[model samples]
Target: MEKTKVFTLVFKTLFFLLIALFFSWGIWNGYFSMIFTESERFLLLLQQHLLLVVTSSLMAVAVAIPLGIFVTRPRFAKSEWFVLNTANLGQTIPVIAILAIVMTYLGIGFNTAVFALFVFSLLPILRNTVAGLNSVDPAMKDAAKGMGLTPMQTLWRIEMPNAMFTIMAGVRTAIVMNIGTAALASLVGGGGLGDLIFAGINLRDNAYLFSGAVPVTLLALTVDGLLRLSERIFIPKGLQEAAKSA
Candidate 1:
């Protein structure tokens, strides 16, 4: 089992290294010559893309985690459906339509894109958080209480820790979706790798298309990889071993 795990790790590392080398070769050889010649701002665009995904994800986390926790309480339990429905409603609309509608009111800029992305990111995180908490073993809660833990203590120490794996799964889904959606921000003057994609489309340049697509794909994979590491580090050790054995 350990040998298989090591082989899997090596394979993934080598795969990522090969992809990194390929992209580096493309950029170094000026495959995007047309793009750089017009404007030398590839790095700037990549940063903007990261900013969009990170900022919007953070904003969603701020609200979703707390709201999820709140709604699970017996006093606030009745509100869960309403809150979840509201998040689900935001997700029902197509992203393009949401961007177009939001742009009309917000007037097409970085902020508008952020607002649209934030709305797009809410449902998964919120839903998973509620599910994670609710799925916590009832016996564990009773044990915590029997040991003289307060409701808040039981939640923070026991419930939250046990539920963290599920919560992180939600976050991973949100961020991955956010990364893909962020590429569309270019349509609204929100600069990201999408600009290169659209530029390629407009100018009929495959170089520009690849220059944009490659980096965005790498970023998503890299972020997901990092979050996977986080899961290993944060999940209770027993759960991790159970996962491995399973």
Candidate 2:
């Protein structure tokens, strides 16, 4: 098992190295010259994209986790179906359509984009939170109660810790998806990497297309990597081992 783990690690390292080299080659060959030629503009768009993703994702996490917790509670259990379905409705709608509806109300720009993305990001995190909490071993909760721990104590000490892995997984998924979706913000004059991509399409410029496309891809990968690292650092060791075993 240890050898297998090492092999997997080495394989992933080499895979990312190859991808890095490919991007480096493309940059060196001026395949992404627009990124350098309009460095200021590119930077601005990149910043806007990052801001949209971060703000929207944070909003989703802030709302969805607590809402998920609320709906999962015994008192609110009957409402879970309604809540899940409502969130699911957001997912069922096309993102572009959602953006259009949001634009109708919010007009346009960063706020509209953030709201739309937040809606898009809610379901995965909410669903995962509920599922994660539900999956916590009943025995553990019972034990916590048996030890005279209060309901809140059981949740904080026993349930939350165990549920964290799945919760983080949901967060990672939402953030990565948000990174890609934020590109669409440019459509509403919100400004993002999509500006370059769409411009490239209109003008038939590969450089512009690659300039935007590459960065978005890289951002998603980087965020996912960071989140994975955070999971390793933050999640309990026993939980990690249990996950591995499972």
Candidate 3:
């Protein structure tokens, strides 16, 4: 354990050092000059990008979690295939195509982007939720019933805790994907770092391209890291130890 901790510390230190070095190189090469030259606009686009990610992710969570839970219930077991396939269909469709369809109906804007993103982000989370719950031990559920616990009690106390790590894994996947997809929102005038990215492409400007690409990459990494930390904090300690052992 001590060796593990030490290795982790060393790894983190090296990681941060590499990030610092990369940014310093970017500064030297003027790759990030747009941030300084067009600070206000850059900031605005960044804010819009974050808003797009947060709003859509939250919406996905709200809809997906319940839908996932619903389809997992024994009463709805027969419908699970249909629901999963529907979500899978949404995911299988190209995100750009989804955006285009949404744009056709909504006529483009932040709301249009959010709706499209919400659709795109739903499947992973819903699938994970169902899988996590389904993976819970039947013996455990039986034991809870023998103890006279109500169905709801068993679900909340015995099931959800065990399933949380998997569900959160899905959420992390969805959110990280959403962050990257949000960049495409610029194509529809949804207003985000995509504006910079597409602009750079059209104008053949490296600075504009890197400005958008770097931030999107960093944001995804940062959010994924935070979600991992949250999983560590929120997942039951016994499960964490069990996971490590596994």
Listed in order, each prediction's TM-score against the native is 0.85, 0.90, 0.91
- Give the number of the best model, judged by TM-score: 3
lDDT score, candidate 1 = 0.91
Model 2 lDDT tens row, 1-246: 999999999999999999999889887878788877889999999998988998999999999999989998888999999999999999999888989999999998888899999999999999999999999989988889999998899888888889999999999999999999888888888899999988888898878889999999999999999999999876899989987999
lDDT of 1 by residue, 83-118 (tens): 999999999998889999999999988998998999
Position 106, candidate 1: lDDT: 95
Query: What is the C-alpha local distance difference test score of each model?
Result: 0.91, 0.92, 0.95
Better-scoring candidate (lDDT), 2 or 3 = 3
Q: Kindly provide the TM-score of model 3 when superposed on the true structure, using C-alpha atoms.
A: 0.91
TM-score of 1: 0.85
Clash totals for all candidate models? 0, 0, 0
Per-residue lDDT of 238 in model 3:
98
The C-alpha RMSD in Å for every predicted model, in order, reads: 3.7, 2.8, 2.9
TM-score of 2: 0.90
Better model by TM-score, 1 or 2?
2
